[model samples]
Target: MAQVHLRDVVKNYGPLEVVHSINLDIADNEFVVLVGPSGCGKSTTLRMIAGLEEISGGEIFIGDNVVNDLPPRERNISMVFQNYALYPHMTVRENLGFSLKIAKRPQAEIDKAVDEAAEILSLTPLLDRKPGALSGGQRQRVAMGRAIVRHPDVFLFDEPLSNLDAKLRTQMRVEIKKLHQKVRSTIVYVTHDQVEAMTLADRIVIMRDGHIEQIGTPLDVFENPVNTFVATFIGSPPMNLLNGVVRDGAVVLEDGTTVPVPPGYQAREGQAVQLGMRADNVMPVGHSLPPTEHMAQIEMDVNLTEPLGTETLLFAELAGAEVQAKMLNPRPVEAGERMTFQVMLDKCHLFDAESGAALRG
Candidate 1:
């Protein structure tokens, strides 16, 4: 029953503020991820929750207790850092049980906790091996096992997979998700990777420049981004934005190409806006998804093609800006080839050109 609550937390170094006052509540046994680009204050926020960094203002509550004044050891939390901080000289079992050992816990209790954590992470076979003897993924598992042996009220993971290779990172993502399902602990993970946030979190907290931009379930943020920054940051290949002005129930681009404003948006005539389109929403007519009721056709010359097995990402220029569209059904097309693509207007978005806020009715 460890629910974490941050009440307008703020962090400042001397006179410069790094983390603006931000509030968040994480439910018990929930997995939440704070994701953003580098220098977004995500890791600083996690460290504040862990009591590793002192808060400049506001209170932090772990369950029913105010932990703002508590030290790291008294916060009843365990943190798994990016670099697997395993002692080189200790075997896997010793490393897992080191915290409890240092705390002067009974040998029987320590052994039981270590054994259970080892079994859970499938590290029972590597208990006798040192960190140097284990692979990166195996070492990460050992790091997680060390955190689990403590059975703390909360688990904080700070980019725990960044050091691993691409394949191992994918594998570890699955492992971390499975671990959450098994342990059911309240987890607050921090990462700059959106894919990890989307795959691992029950809810995501997106931050920028020390301020929280948005917080919602992955699908909620993906399908309904609140602004242009979020619309571009949450998805791979980024969303294509075309600057235009609303005129006669349509958006007119710089090149005199007019497209109907996406449905549900109340745009005034003569209003400046940016039309947002994901690569998935724009595709070659023959290779596109089943047609939607509200669609717009546009012609563009392909500049490049990125064949990704079942699908290819087509790069083109639209309205003076580079645009990315997906090509389904697998086709070979030379550069500079002209193609007509369909845009799913129902899935498109409209944002205020100046402020970057979503234009919703």
Candidate 2:
């Protein structure tokens, strides 16, 4: 395993600069994921690290070697892309052993490596099947097995699970995590899915436009987002945002609703801000709400309810904005009914209205 480092990395397509100068240090054996919306330069960055795309500026280091001018074959890195990229005419065993065969490795060693990869991926049953007959998930495993055969210093994945169904994607996410533990190799994965990023990464790098927004463990970025963009982008259902102003040590929402400011906050009396609260933190009464340091109770009309088996997602009107709240151990909730909800004030986030930067105390 080797550490991957990027210093002031930049990318450009002729006159248009896509990726701004970015700096990241991925520790040895670390499973780092680069995630963002489409065209955010995540795949481009991954390609640069794999030596598939040329860098416009700065340097990339794999362990103690400077691999700026190295070709893909010389970089000792294997990349699995979104498409399976397996040969239709080749059997799973052949596909896994092709790279070694191309390097003129002895047939016995190639067979040994192929068998080992098949065992690790549980693909021994499908080894004789051609890519055409295999399922999507199985074909993807063969793609990963090919990479495993190389025993590369770094493994790169470019949204490798995007082509699968939701259920299969979840299963593969767990398989990929186990693969990391079994191989103990450095991996750089790229994806636009926050669910995948949250579940599989040791640390996640959130990108927007062409710049890195924030980099931290999934929980760190989720709990303490630096800006409104990150706050809304990193979570499911996203964080609810209510535009308002701070007055009288409380936040006044657009519809004249007032919610207590989070404790220990320092802001001007009349400063404009956006108040944010996660769905789980703000729920209807009688949901076993925890003992929060600061909380606010408000009456709001329920707009809709989405029952998701274990819990229901309640949508309601708050300060004239549609806010989503979670209801665990839920009872039947009808639309148009009035309900009293509690907002966990201590977990709330405040951001400047003008710049959208988090207002830290």
- What does the lDDT read for residue 16 in candidate 2? 93
What local distance difference test score does each model get? 0.95, 0.92
Candidate 1 error regions (>4 Å): none
Report how far off residue 252 is in candidate 2 (Å): 1.1
lDDT of 1: 0.95
Residues 1-361 of candidate 2: C-alpha lDDT, one tens digit per residue: 4999998999999999889999999999999999999999999999999998999999999998889899989989998989989988899999999999999999999999999999999999999999999999998999999999999999999999999999999999999999999999999999999989999999999999889999999999999998899999999889999999999988899989988788656568999999988998888889746757678987889999999988899999887798989888989999999998988888889988898888889
In candidate 1, what are the lDDT values of residues 1-361, reduced to their tens digit? 7999999999999999989999999999999999999999999999999999999999999999999999999999999998988999999989999999999999999999999999999999999999999999999999999999998999999999999999999999999999999998999999999999999999999999999999999999998999999999999989999999999999999998889999988788999999999999999989998998999999999999999999999999888988999999878999999999999999999999999999987
- Deviation in Å, model 1, residue 312 alpha carbon: 1.1
lDDT of 2 at 195: 89
Candidate 1 minimal-lDDT segment of 10 residues: 262-271
RMSD of each: 1.0, 1.2
